[model samples]
Target chain A: MDDEQQEKQHLANDGRQMTLIDQIIRNKVFNCRYWKEDCFGLTAVTLVDKACKLDCVGATYSGTGKPVPFLCLLMKLLQINPDKEIIIEFLKSKDYKYISALAMFYIRLTSKPKEAYPTIEQFYADFRKIRIRNLDGTFAIWHMDELAEKLLSEEIIFGISLPRFQKRWILEELGQLEPRKSVLEEELQNQEQEQVQVAEQQNQEKDQEQGQEQ
Target chain B: SDDGKQKLNDEDTLDETEYALWKIRELKRIKQFNDEKNKYEIEKAEIDRRRNLTDMQRIQEDFKLGSDKTKMEDKTKYV
Candidate 1:
């Protein structure tokens, strides 16, 4: 067969091995953390499983402690509601900048070409002004306009080559977006149709008044 | 009233010293835990990196060896 076919087979094998390793890692992580006093009572078994499968063994935690709960929370949100309305609402939140950043990043990953803009544009002004604690426990403010600009300008936002293998670990496991088209044009068309209808109704009323008066 | 004030002041001093001791112990325990955590993390990373390298090497070797690769044996084995 061709080199392309060989390459495709190689990739499939690579994916299969990766998942196998992922399952084993998940098993070890659960076995280790599940019995810890702090983690013993935690609920949401499915979310915890998803969180464990995330490759964070070597991740640098903040000064406070372990990695940010970004992955776990994102998993929980996706598991509970794939509609992403709750996550979108998180963007409007002024209280938690880190959570907002997670939401913004999620949008970057999930949004369709045109549907991205309006969903993200309003949050732009807010998040740029927001500050978040990094994984290293350092306080940092988001250059939100820079981030927005990056998302809008780039095609492959999460697939940057520098952090090669671990980029997948950093990003939330992608959840499907509900099918949506930009409704701006449709809304405008609807308004125009309503205006025409209102005009026709007004003319009819005027004609009736004239007939009655006559 | 003067005697009562003196007792209250003594109690305050004892409480302050006790709280200071608690803080010191707490800080020490936290530092030890973090040190242990960091050491465990380093160990885990080393183990993972080695495993990852082996996995990559094995995959590359398998690809290089090719699907048709098989052991040579006695002449009549396939027949």
Candidate 2:
């Protein structure tokens, strides 16, 4: 084969081996489960579709026109349905990292707008109340750290200061207490000891029964 | 003999054109197939990544429960 034919064959081979990262990105772009049917969700899907097309056409951006950050897109979604079933569905998806990333983007965007700064406290409060439902419709709560980074970033960007009481309450209620630091540690240890004792007693009883048999 | 040679050359040129056109069509087909495969792969990878994150979160929760059980034991002994 000529050099041109050889080059074409190599390109074809390379195309066949699509990487894992590419697949993950494509799923995010093409899949609708990450978004709801509301305005924010629709907008996000549209923006993503545009991004996919742009990527396909081999267009380069100067970074000035990058689509709204993922978090902003999510916030738009939240605005459309602050407490909708679709929100929980999106959260339940394995793509929580993308969702978290989008949450941070919204926090930053809102913080930057002077008018939106006043709403930060209320947003934080509402966020604390956000509960996700599993596929079976069971409610599942997410951790504070899942929220803290974005909340802190929003606070920093907006210059909105939360009350000390509000901060303490959220920290105490939402933060994941370390295993060693939890008050339940002693109780758990005692249970383990009791279990061991029960097992020993059962063994002794078995031994006596065997002796009787002998 | 010269006329026969000319006719053979024409046939050779026609064959080359046909071959080139076939190759071009094949390349287009390959490109379309790759595009679709890439799209599916991207969606699957995203789903798997999310699943892994959920699993990790569950494991962490189980560890927390185990620790809580230990703590309860310690408290009961002290009381």
DockQ of 1: 0.01
- List candidate 1 segments past 4 Å from native: A1-66, A133-138, A153-214, B1-79
lDDT per residue for candidate 2 within B28-61, as digits (tens), equals: 4345535755676688787786577776675676
Worst lDDT 10-window in candidate 1 chain B: B4-13
What C-alpha lDDT, on a 0 to 100 scale, does residue A71 get in candidate 2? Answer: 23
Question: What lDDT is reached at residue B34 by model 1?
Answer: 51
Candidate 1, residue A149: how far the Cα is off, in Å? 3.0
DockQ by candidate, in order = 0.01, 0.01
Question: What is residue B64's positional error in candidate 1, in angstroms?
Answer: 44
**lDDT for model 1:** 0.43
Native contacts present in candidate 1, fraction: 0.00
Give one digit per residue, the lDDT tens place, for model 1 in B1-79. Answer: 1232233221122255554553454444345535755676688787787577776676676567763235333434965
Instruction: Tell me how far the alpha carbon of residue A180 in candidate 2 is from the true structure, in angstroms, after superposition.
Output: 13
Give chain B TM-scores in order.
0.50, 0.45
